[model samples]
Target: MKILIVGGGMGGTILGNNLARRLAPEMRAGKVQLKMLSASDKHMYQPGLLYLALGRMTPDELYRDQVSLLEPGIDFEVDPVVSFELDHNQVKTKSGKTHGYDILVIATGSRPVPEMIPGLAENAETFYTEETALKMFKRLQAFQGGRVVIAVGVPHKCPMAPLEITFMLHDYFKDRGIRDKVELHYTYPVGRVHSLENVAKWAAPEFDRLGITYETLFNMKEVDGANKVVKTEEGSEAKYDLLITIPAHKGMEVIESNKLGAGGFIPTDKTKLTMEGRTNVYVIGDTTNIPISKAGSTVHYQVETLGENLAAIVKLGSPVREHDGKVFCFIECGKDRATYATFNYTVPPDPKPPTRAVHWFKMAYNKLYWTSARGLL
Candidate 1:
């Protein structure tokens, strides 16, 4: 059996490594072949971009050679797929090669589209990618004191990033002794500060305690960069001297061009984790239109369930696992403290207060992510 994996993001890496370990004997016996195709040879720990923006981590620490993280039995390549001819059980790659597979897993992932909002790309600072994070860091360094506004959009990755950055900004300006001079304000699209009800409930008081002003029901329409104002779809405006934004996200352009799913996200079965209308093709991570937070833990958990089911299919000729929508995230609260949220489909998240221990553990996990990707943790 030829198992082809597309995209080398978090979901792809873990799933590739997991499958290699589970099907090692089959691979050795020439019964199963696992191969992965990615856009780059370097694998990035994406969550570290948040810390990179805060000057807590460096660029060198965020990357590893993709080959170093995979198990021996898996074949890895840096060529990206340009066309997905699912009907033929094949994909055409940029390298002019067509790869066939019995089972295909698409984890092409998502990208933030600040350009979608008029003038947002030129006006606001974002930390979603390495280039943007570095620019945002420099912007923060140059910012002395003014109305610092955080504008959030929907379907973005790392759901807690806006709140985490807000708290971090409070600490940042406080450290610079400009806390009194800076007016930290946050605006959200929905009526609540967060999509998660309990998280929104927990964040409100935390914002109050930190003296961070916020306005909900503020959907982004466009940015008046010259006037230093953000016009919302609701017809309200937020004035700012410095604007930080968590822009909306969409799946890869290849997915869009292929007409896989709306906005590039592939329609996926919430429980089976398979692409709609195709049992042999699977979807995970930011690629899936599952209406869940597009966070790393979501990818991590989905890979776990997929690895088990794929292995079960090889061993039992049938699958026996369902993704439970499990997700976990560590929310940095600044002040060297952090908290976490864990939830599944049946259970809602109830976050606890920030603690230094959890913060340190999150720090440790940052280093251990490579091990986790190797299917060792």
Candidate 2:
């Protein structure tokens, strides 16, 4: 059997390695083949981009060659996928070639869809892509003082990122002795800071302490760049000298052309990572519309379950592992401090509230996680 994996983000790369190692014995027996397709040769450590944007880290620290990272015995393809013919179990690449697979894993992840919001794509600058993010970082450094608004667009990857930006901006201006010259505003479509009440509670006090103004349940509709104003769905206009917005995120166009799910995100069973209504197709990571935080930790959590289940499917033709929607986030609050929050789909009896201690733990975990993943210890 041949397996085709798309998109070499955190989930795809890790899952590819896990599956390659797991199926090595099967490959020796001529029973399995694994192939990974990615659009670029550079593998980006996305979470680190946050630190990079804040000037706390450098770009070299967040990038690795894709060819050097994949596990041995897995074939890597550096080409963009143009479309997927689900009925034929084949994918067409931008290079005008087609590859067929017995099993396909869709991990193409989401990208910023700024056009979803009127004038957003043309007006406000975004930090979703590596290129745009670096540009924004430079702009932020030169910013003297003005009405700086950090707004969250719908279905964003890493739900806490906007909040992180807000906190870091607060700390940035304060250190520059221009905190009073700048007015910070954070807007989100959700009615609260975070979807989880526990997280919102932890974040609320900090926002208040920082004196950052925020609007909840306010969906940004248009960015009137000519007037330096943002209009929300509630008919409210926010004036700003500079706008840093998180644009709407959507799955790869290939997934949408194939009619996979709404916004091109594949619908999957959380436990198995298997694409719903399809046999022998699985999806992991940010490409799926999973009701969980779309972060690297989520990818790591899903990979283990997906590997075991895939192995079970190969050995016994049945899934033997279940996935628990467990996710952990390391939220950087600037000033060299961060917070750690872990949650499962099922509510915990006692959710550990966020604390300063969690901040230190988050910093420590970053070193540990990167070292482990890169085998650099």
Candidate 3:
């Protein structure tokens, strides 16, 4: 059997590496084939981008070549996938080439859709993508003082990213002796500051201590760039000097055109990561409508599970395991400190509350994860 994995992201690359090493003997004996399709040659350490935007890390630290990262035996395709022909069990690329596969893994991660929100295209700045992060960094460097509003858009990757931005901004101004000059506000559509109520319980105290204003359950309707104002559904207006907005996110257009699931996200059995209607297709990462925080760690766990199940299917022709809906995240709260939270559908039923030890654990885990992945630690 041949496996075709699309989008060499955290999920794709990690799973590709795992499969390549484990299946090398079988592949050498002509038992199976593995191929990875990616849109770009660059493999970025995306979690590091948050530090880069905060002026704590450099861009060079986030760069790695995709070819160099993967094992030599895995075939790598550098092309953009334009469509998925589910009927033919094939995928068509922008270059007019088609790939047929027995099993297809969709990891074509989500992207920010700034145009989906009015006035965001013209006035609002963002830090979702690397390009936008760098642009916002430049703007932040030159910003003297103003009402800086950091707003969280719907269905964004990394639910705590907005809070990270807010904390980093507070630290930035404190260092520049302009903490009093800037009025920082964090607005979210959710009923709480953090998506998880347990985290929100801790976050509330932090926001109060930082003197940052917050509005929960307020959905941003439009950004009146001309007047430097943000309008919400509650008929409330917020004036800002700088607008850092997280726009709506969506799955790849190919998935959307195929009518995969509600809002373009593929509906998958949470444990299996298999596409609901199709037997041969499986999806991992942010492309699936999983009821969990869409973070890199969540993808890592899903990919590990997927690799094992795929191996069982190819070799034993039987399903082996189920996903536990486990997710963990390290939320950086500035001051050289962070907090870690772990949650599973069965346990606690809420994000584990943060502790001072979890904060240090987050700092240490960053090094541990990077080192393990890069073979440094």
Best by lDDT: 1
Q: Which of the numbered candidates is closest to the native, going by highest TM-score?
A: 1
CA-only RMSD, every prediction: 0.7, 2.3, 2.3
- Where model 2 places Cα greater than 4 Å from the true spot, the runs are 348-377
Instruction: Write model 3 residue lDDT over 1-377, tens digit each, in one string.
Output: 89999988878888887787667788888888999998989887777777777676678877778887787678998997888888899999988999999999999888888787788757877877788878888888899899999876788888878887888789888998999999999988878898777888888888999999998886778889999998887777888999988678888777788777767688988988898888889999998998877788888888778888888887789769999988877877874667767787786434454456766776566556544343222
Local distance difference test scores for all models: 0.94, 0.80, 0.81
- Sorting all predicted structures by TM-score, with the top scorer first, yields 1, 3, 2
What's the number of clashes in each of the models? Answer: 0, 1, 1
TM-score of each: 0.99, 0.92, 0.93
Task: Between candidates 2 and 3, name the one with more favorable lDDT.
Answer: 3
Clashing pairs in 1: none
lDDT of 1 at 61: 99
Estimate candidate 2's alpha-carbon lDDT, on a 0 to 1 scale.
0.80
lDDT of 3: 0.81
Flag regions of model 1 displaced more than 4 Å.
Answer: none
